[model samples]
Target: MRTTRSRTVAALGVCSALVAGPLTAPAAADVADLRLDQWGLDTVGAAEVWEETRGSGVTVALLDTGVVTDHPDLDEVTVGPDLTGQDLSPDSDGYGVHGTMMAGIIAASGHGIEHTGGVMGVAPQAEILSIRVAAEADAAGGGETDPGALAAGIRHAVAEGVQVICIPLPDAAFSVQGDEAERDAVAHAVDNGVVVVASGGADGEAVYPAAYPGVLAVGSVGADGALSEFSSRGEHIALTAPGEEVTVLDADGGYTTVTGSDAAAAFTAGVAALIRAEYPQLQPEQVAEALTGGAVAPAAGAEQPGHGAGVLSAPGAMAAAGTTAESVPPFDPELAEQLADDPLVPRWVLWTGGAVLLVLLAVVGLVVLRRRSADPYGLGRRTPETERRPVRGRRRRGRGRRGVSR
Candidate 1:
């Protein structure tokens, strides 16, 4: 695993509204009032999307530092293996802080007393699978987390049959050379019809495995629907979500607002969960298309390079029709012909050609040796110096004593 300086944006203190006072308890008949303070809910049309599905059957895998499984907002979270090499419990305070925050953003259920009118996620009913792959020590020490652990976590999520994999960390956590195992694991997830969502880096550079093909790269946008300056920009970005000033439950049982592409990715993953629950038959690519195609255009003058399709709209995606596998168009004949004529050969063919060449060279070497051994006086061979000595002696005697002496 490659190590580098930490690039994750730390979570800021809770939003001002939550700090003012404890939320008033909702009346028994009005459960909708419980989430009135969640601006993100309304901004992304979560309430309307909830009418169709709350992501009941979808399981979103959170591959991060860890999660506070016992938090009021995260009652439905299931703690998975700790790939970070830390033996801490899922609800541990110090190490799992970042992962806990992301969990609240995705599937916080708000089940405890202190959270009665607290933070509610986009997919309030979705289940969270907390897979701890990021190391707290590495992060604090300004070192990159293990990419192998991340790759293993992705494979584990796929094996568990998760519908969505949410990586709420930045690009710097990955190696510059790109870990082949991590990339292959992500590809495996996509091939198995799993939606992989990752944060576009905060420093305006493309990041992996977000930059990898078939992954949904998310950028950050603010509540006002403008692109956040810190959000990374690139052609790989698939969509933008409300990332700035986004309120989420922290590890200390408090609400806090975070700003970065991590929050955007978590929010986008939640939206993906909603889509999966509403349209279980849709393939990963089709689900991605729904999110991108259904995104609302940003306000004038607010668009940025990484602000991909636009800001996420849960209601729009949920209401959008699902695409069947057969709906995809066939490959164009011209493109197919071009590919056939391309000089780049497949890996298997290259290996086979190399093996054939080695065999041919060995056969040629053996044939040359055999031909030389069979005919000692072959045309290509030179006569021994001893045989030519007699001829020279005859010539010298014939010439005269003076010639021989000369």
Candidate 2:
């Protein structure tokens, strides 16, 4: 099989961690061998998407691990940059395949690539913009871990005029640096009318870039339409996509889904490209609307894992975008109420009240303590004679009022 590029949500990871299945080989692809439809991939709907958009002139940027551009599935990844400083060659460690997997999901053309039987992408038509940010954390050995590299890569993608940006990698620090950088870049794109799709972390929460406002945070669903334990859940999730196990050449060189949300994120981004093409006049908000509006609610017993929106429905999204349906739904009342009742409150308001109360309490307590500390006696001073009282009459012996001792 031909080697190509890179490749979940939080719950999916948890499930994968718990699952112990024998490593299965990648699907030997023939149209008949394509299990995607059986897995509920909606290939017919994808064709409907191609019938309209064909992802023409659209570029989906993948910012994460390095992509193997030479993979047969990724022939359309003609333009990209190496943001990560590791080897871009095909024979790198198994970990470096993350980006390639993502690229495949967005746009791999692996029709004839040899030895590359199973790992096919969702969007084989869209062009991929690979901006590798972090170094290999896998078998390719490790490389530098710079948050700045990720920021710089985002800015560069914005400058490059890509239509859609997909970010699957997450930062462990949980600070706002990467989030701010990615958000700013996204805003820059929005000003130019670009759409961004991001994958939440495979652990517990939506990662930076995805967690930021304005960007669409996508989650994953298993074959049964249930939320994988690894699929992160929260209000941050804007939509869900299929994220079942796909055979990857794991660390043991055996095929199995070591992980897959990265693929889901890319797949969703590809769908975004389709919507963009069909409704070229729609703004970023409108595109987001089309996606969220079209998503199917999560499968039963798994609804909590959804963004309250449904799984990725590419056909539904395209159809929704083509129509003039009411774009964005009103905010959820429950969410609004919860936010309003938040006890933490705003920082400035909390600090202001705290400072005012602190000063007043300090002043009042100080006045009381000062009065106490300043007092020589509790109520009034006790005269020494009052205390000694001339030793109650025996004092006359020692002092004699000058000399009578007995």
Candidate 3:
């Protein structure tokens, strides 16, 4: 567990108020036991991904509660500044629980000989930069949710040259809006070729950074692959992943199950890492395309309201990365048509504009025809003097290359 602690810590406490899960210890588990519990890995085709690349050379920035660096399963993690100003100790109440859980989902390398025990991550070979952005909110709303700190954390991660940034907390978790510093920070990350993955929130509508453009907003899905009811629904959702009852590492170095879009975002971030590692030359938006292009639509042949492209497919994303091929965006035609009716220029306005253009063209054509009819030559506009003076030997045709006898 390595950390670069900040000299000045803010007094505002932080904890997980966005996700819902209770930390419960289980008996010592081996790799087999943990693997059995990780239904998400299989759902996202992580096994197939391991055969290609275990996400080597990819670093994911986890902006959430600080991580438990010493967790047996978490092999690669660098704890960054404690921006939340909460106690940095691992034993602090709910300090790093959520972040640790998210980290495990992203890149826990497992423990023991041959790495066969503990929680295995989607990108086991990937690295984690755990930045303590916030923690569970206290009962009295004492959790310090600083938008500026989050922005700083994002910029810090980008400056560190991380390949991906995972925000386990939704925009609603902290009060933020588009065009704020946080939004600009997100933009900066994207512009710098960093892929940003964020929770779409558990509530109905997406908020803030998740809803911001270029952020891959993730939703939650259960073992059955159906969208989780608790997962937020919005037009911004990029895709769904296993988040319901997903097994993760607790701060106490034990295994526990969590259910929320937070886990989904983490898992998606890991997928992005895998894509980045496999296709290093691909830009951030191209990596995002691979994710959406490789996703599978729902069984009903219709996109769920907020499921974006569909369920994520790890192998599919790898195959789709760095390609210029187009994939169908998950959208309901009926709904899209309804939305399309309200274009920036109303249908009536467009019709009027077209009519005016046609009228102008017709009037110009009429004037040209009248002019040509009045003057059988392609000379200047006809005048009484030119009409009266028919002294020319031979009139030139309509702008032809023939010489006019003057």
Candidate 4:
């Protein structure tokens, strides 16, 4: 129920691609070709991922403006709380503009018998849990950014058992310095095994929630696979995705081209959803590793300025996930038995112990020499057994002396 006065900007720019508002139905065959223009989907390798899974059975918690569920391409959308304290009805101005765009980028289902036309998200089968945490636009053409609402939304999403949480604010709408509530909320989500994804801010600053320790901070890339001019740089960036001029749903149920960190974050979240759907048992950090570890940079060992690990590759991530899953063997009593055949102590430990024993014996011999020199009746003093068995070097001399005397 917390609120704030800080304004949140949905995207850096929004340009009308097709006519805004409800669109006339196009030819049935032409509908399927609508996705051909969506270069962002191809950039992220959504087709290859579709062959495996479309993020089925995964729910993405979108903490942003409210979303419009009537979009033809969008699948199931469950509306949650409205923390913005504003009217989120369809009649409202700028109703869910940004949120709708993010939803489409994550899980927009094509419209038609063949599921063609409109936008197709990376994880088209994934469901959406919409929680309005900020206003897309206000009456004066400006809206407030509420970190309090964001924190509350995160906790609520975790409570709802969401696998992935997406925050599409690609700008530093407000400062999160010393925002313990927001920090704790993100931590709570990650601790519950939820994968938190956010944009690194288009203003070239590493923003909060995204800057939070466990969240996956995403950056922006263009269709050419180059870093976007607006994407933020620095160590906080974890991955990059197509964001500039990306195709998404407009507030009026039509398609539009928008540019910002929002698309980047949404695409990354969709990838996270796909990973979750494919490997439900993978931990949050392991999912993140599959993403960053599998990203392909522009060149081998060459770093992209703001592209984090590099551009997101869905197939590569899945491959890395496979390797990771194979390496992390599941619980098996037979596997334990297989390892039990090996020695309990390592070779290094045995070698080290032997060397240490030799050193200790030498030290004891030196100590005895010193003690015998100081006190004739000490440890070095000869006992009866030593007298009977003469010292090796003296035994020969003693026999020769006995022979000479005889």
Find the candidate with the highest TM-score and give its number: 4
lDDT by residue (tens digit), candidate 2, 244-363: 664332222212343445556766888888876555667788888888888776657644754447778888888778774345343343566678787447778988999999999999
Candidate 4 to truth, TM: 0.72
Ranking by lDDT: 4, 3, 1, 2
294, model 3: CA deviation in Å?
0.4
Distance from true location, Cα of 364 in model 1, Å: 52
Error (Å) of candidate 4 at residue 214 is 0.4
Off by over 4 Å in 3: 1-31, 87-93, 138-144, 170-176, 322-406
Clashing pairs in 3: 14-135, 15-135, 15-136, 15-137, 16-135, 16-136, 31-116, 31-117
Where is the poorest 10-residue window by lDDT in model 1? 4-13
Q: Can you give the TM-score per candidate against the true fold? A: 0.70, 0.63, 0.70, 0.72
**Candidate 1 lDDT, 48-76, residue by residue in tens:** 87777888978999998888755656768
RMSD, one per candidate, in order: 14.7, 18.7, 17.8, 13.3
- How would you encode candidate 3's per-residue C-alpha lDDT over 361-384 as one tens digit per residue? 999999999988987876678577
Better of 2 and 4 by TM-score: 4
